[model samples]
Target: MIIPFWSRLRLAPRIVLVIIGALLAMKAVDKAMPLVIRPPEAMFFDRDWLLATLQDIRDRSITAPAAERPALLRDLPVRQWLDITLLSSPPDFRHSEREGGFTDLHRRITDRLGLTPQDVLLKADEPDDPEYSPRPLVIILPPLPTVIMDVFDDRSANMLSSDLRIAFRIGPQEDWLVVTPKSDGQEIVRMTRNVALPLLAVVLIGLLSVWVARGIVKPLDDLAEAAEKLGRDREPRLVGSFNAPELQAIGNSFNAMQLRLKRFVDDRLQMIAAISHDLRTPLTRLRLFAEYLPDPDQRRQVMSDIAEMEAMMSATLTFASTQLKDEPRSPSDLAAMLISLCDTAADAGCMVAYEGPDHARLVYRPVAMRRAFANLIDNGCKFGSHVWVRLRETPDAFVITVSDDGPGIPPDQFENAFRPFVRLESSRNRDTGGTGLGLTIAQDIILTHDGDIMLSAAPDTNGLVVTVTLPRQG
Candidate 1:
């Protein structure tokens, strides 16, 4: 059964996306719901109380002075605000434009102050007092400009202050409650929803984005680890393709890359072998022609040079022919190969020995392995008094070390040994000679077989120790 592409997403980031999706859904609901409803109103005294207050003030006009007014007005809660309006009544008829819609109060004050029609009138709210009560209208005239008292908690009074309309009203002791038209409840709800809805949506989106990031990142990390193991020449560890299309493609491409590289190495080795055959023919002709030289020492020298040239060419060509094509037939016992190479070096009049384990194995080209070891042992014989070959094999790899008791190489020239055709001499004469390609060919062979070569000062033994580590076949 095939899984859908989205199913391949990992847990953590998917959770994040789900949370973001939820917030967006909430915001959508919030916006859609409120577009359907309307806006609440505030209320005060009933019609009976309003008309009665107006009638009482008309009948009981007080002859009381300002100081006596507060005491007498306090007898009725509604009466307290009447004294306030009486003090402010003169100016309320003045400054007519500031009166808002209270034209009734404006007319009353105009009569009391005996102001002509051209006199200005103003109206303003009463200052809040603990002892005073609410009175909803005021009118001002020019004579009363220095003081103001009465407009109240009524909404119409608020609207007048905000200059929405002209206020009109007609007396003191009258409870005419005014209302300012507004949809404040609806405005506040919309503001709250506008802020909350988007925040919820962003939270949901954040969750979803985190989920996607993790899903994409996880497969790539696995693919990278697999590639590294393949590059280090470890076992071919197979990773299953992901449900995601891009990740599957990446896995397929890496598998194809490995196949092409192996085939390329095989084809290249075949080409090198063909080139070696062409090189050998001319060298053979020169060896035959050297026999006709007249002087005895010169003839002997020519033969020696020809013999050395043949050996060097044969070694170099053998290296090129097999380095890439030699598929590892089986893991060979590494301990046995090193012991055998040391014995051969000893027979050639070099003091050589082996250290480390008796049985350690590695996957390699058998012929190439023997050749690389022979070159290293031969180099040891040329440069050192005594040679020791050591082995350190782990579950992952086997390292072969060759150390000697000869004079150490110069600190600067260690890497020079690995270059082809570049030779550093401890001996001045041109007598010690081979194709300067021996160490170079050995390194190439080890590298092709997924091994590494290193040269360092030998521990307490006074010369260089060359190490080669080949991966152990599992």
Candidate 2:
């Protein structure tokens, strides 16, 4: 059956769950398989050697002299710490005395031989060095997978069940193997993990998860954020590149959409400019004809209309074109720019002041950025008595604030004021005349430079303060 892609994908194996299960299984088996063992037979002792020792002891003690009994034990070799501590009563009591004494003697052989607990009695090839005497080999391998055994003391007997671990060297590798008592319980099984397979599974699955996350979620998150910014009237951002061909195509599509949006906006702005320009030519011809009117007041009124039309046409061009379209990017001194702007404004009889350090260099388009600054200062001069232009450096960005001290716009109109031809009623009058493209042009220029233009109510005044923040370019 040809199932839909989504349904087929949903029915595919649960990769994460499968990986986790396989890791656990492999870890369990890795530790468990090494201990595939059956319990040693009860009282596991060498059959031939043990029987011979028993027989030899029985023969020596049978009607033997007291002095010869000790010599008989010395002639034969036997290990210490071996004995039949518990024995059922024998069918015949004669074997009881003979066998019982022999068993007891074997247990006390170390004391009889005048050897320390480290000395091995049964070992055939003892070293010539006094300290190198062979010790009894203790094979205490546990039936379970794991055990905790410690070897802490020097004088110790290994051929017993109580002490089970010893520290030793094998070539270059050094490790301690803890072999426990014959009484292996559930504790050993619980401590051990089937670690080998789980280790392989975990490493492989971890790498796969990282690749999936990077290829899918990370790129998607970036695209989502860019889309959100575009929707919020912010500049369209680029998704750059992606490893997935599907995502690369998606990114290219978004770029195309952004290009179309920019073109649409540009066409709208150009239409407004064209209409304003067409209206101004006729208005200029009308003013020339009005000059011949007999009434002075009527003639002046016609000329004022022509002047207003010309200002509107010029502002529309400035706003539509956003200053010189190609302002060469250059390394500019921000402090110097502010000082120069302040000096020019002051020369033009504007009460403007500049404050900051002497040198702050940043790479920017000098002419376009200067026009933005001029617009802001001109607004301050038009509305307020005192204009303060401050340039300062912050850790993340450079800030320029142009503040005025006059009646400011209402808090609600702060954003609306930046739109083209959207002037305040007070600013619209012939006395404080403006086309209202000053703030709009400034904002567009700032945006083109990847900077921001913000307007806020100036403290201690009824005036608006404009702030421009630009990211530092290296």
Candidate 3:
């Protein structure tokens, strides 16, 4: 199931998925690093150091005698963070225990001092109170000072203005530890930087992946377009060079294949043209010899047979010659051309009618297209009394249908009728079919113009319809 799913994805999307997977894997490694190995001091704050410093401050303040405790607290030589003053009367400020790491902090301080949890009280600063304003101060000691200051700048400082303040008594000494807690904002900034840097790296990696994928996929796209052109035209251009080694090899292979196909087709057409040219001399000599026969009926019979042979050879030569010829393209009124062909046929006593716009212009080989249409229209007249010619234009091509009211060929023999010299028995009577090359010639000319011709039964009639599709101008 996984294999099938993966196989369904296109190259570019698969490349993108691989890039995202790599980034996520890198992020997992990044998250796991602090647990597996210690990071540099700049990456995080040292919580152990903060806990030890708090404990040491408490020990020093408590060991001092009650009489000189206030002076000792003021001169404690600690980092300039807390306002360590002893109250003359019992403390007026009520301290309430708050949630989070501070609860554990309170417990740790009490356990180290060999006192109960009740002996220490931790409280958070209330910003809404008019009387109390918490000042932003740095407590983390040097070398680390610069790191913390850089991470927690003025914007973070403003957010951390309401700092946590803990007020607690040691025994009955009336001395309280008034200290600010660690900056939650600074920790938040450090964590965000950790996550954001990797995310930015992943974004850059994604962009690089897209660039590489496009480079790889572009050659394949060009190859597909070239294949389509090759189908429509014998002379399609070679694909451009590609950066990838595999794509370059494929392009070389495609160019070789095109050359082989073109050579094969040209060789076959040339051989047919040569064969038809060689047969004409013997055919002409036969006609001349038949004119000199003694019996008049025999002479007439031989001449008629020779004339039919000559007609067949002439048609084959013409079809081969047309296939080898290159016609220049020019803009012409397609409707007018069809109308003129129908009018000429009508003038010649064929019941043919044209139905389309007055002047729809398109780029095409004038002589080749006119000959192809003439062949189809003439075939329609030969097989059936009334012929209807209709022309319609689409955005990409022009569709022309020539329908006849004669008995249509069987569906099974529809394809066979387009083969050179292949005449169905139903239409093989000399009065109706000539040399069996009419449809073949029309198909050949249409194909040379990057178009197609198909034979089908006419809609709502028992007759044949020849549908010709020709490309429009650029």
* lDDT (0 to 1) per candidate: 0.59, 0.60, 0.70
Residues 1-474, model 3: lDDT tens digits: 254575455555767777787778677766765574333222232445655666777777767777776777667665354455455444556655555444555676677666667656656443442112223333222223344454335332222224455556665655566665433244444445556657877777777677767777788899988886776465666998766556778899998998899788778878987887898899889988988899999999898888887777777776867443387888888899999999999999999988889998988888878888998998899889999999898889899999999888888999899888787978645655388888887877787777888989988788999998888843
Best-to-worst order by TM-score is: 2, 3, 1
Model 2 C-alpha RMSD vs. true structure (Å) is 14.1
Q: Would you estimate the TM-scores of all the predictions?
A: 0.47, 0.57, 0.57
Point to the candidate with the largest lDDT.
3
Candidate 2 residue 220 Cα shift, in angstroms, is 3.4
- In Å, residue 156's CA in model 3 sits off its true spot by 28
- Backbone clash total, candidate 3: 0
Q: What residue pairs are clashing in model 2?
A: 27-194, 27-195, 28-194, 408-462
**lDDT per residue (tens digit) for residues 282-334 in model 2:** 88779789989899998898888778778778878877764454666788987
Which 10 consecutive positions of candidate 2 have the poorest summed lDDT?
A: 167-176
User: lDDT at 278 for candidate 1?
Assistant: 72
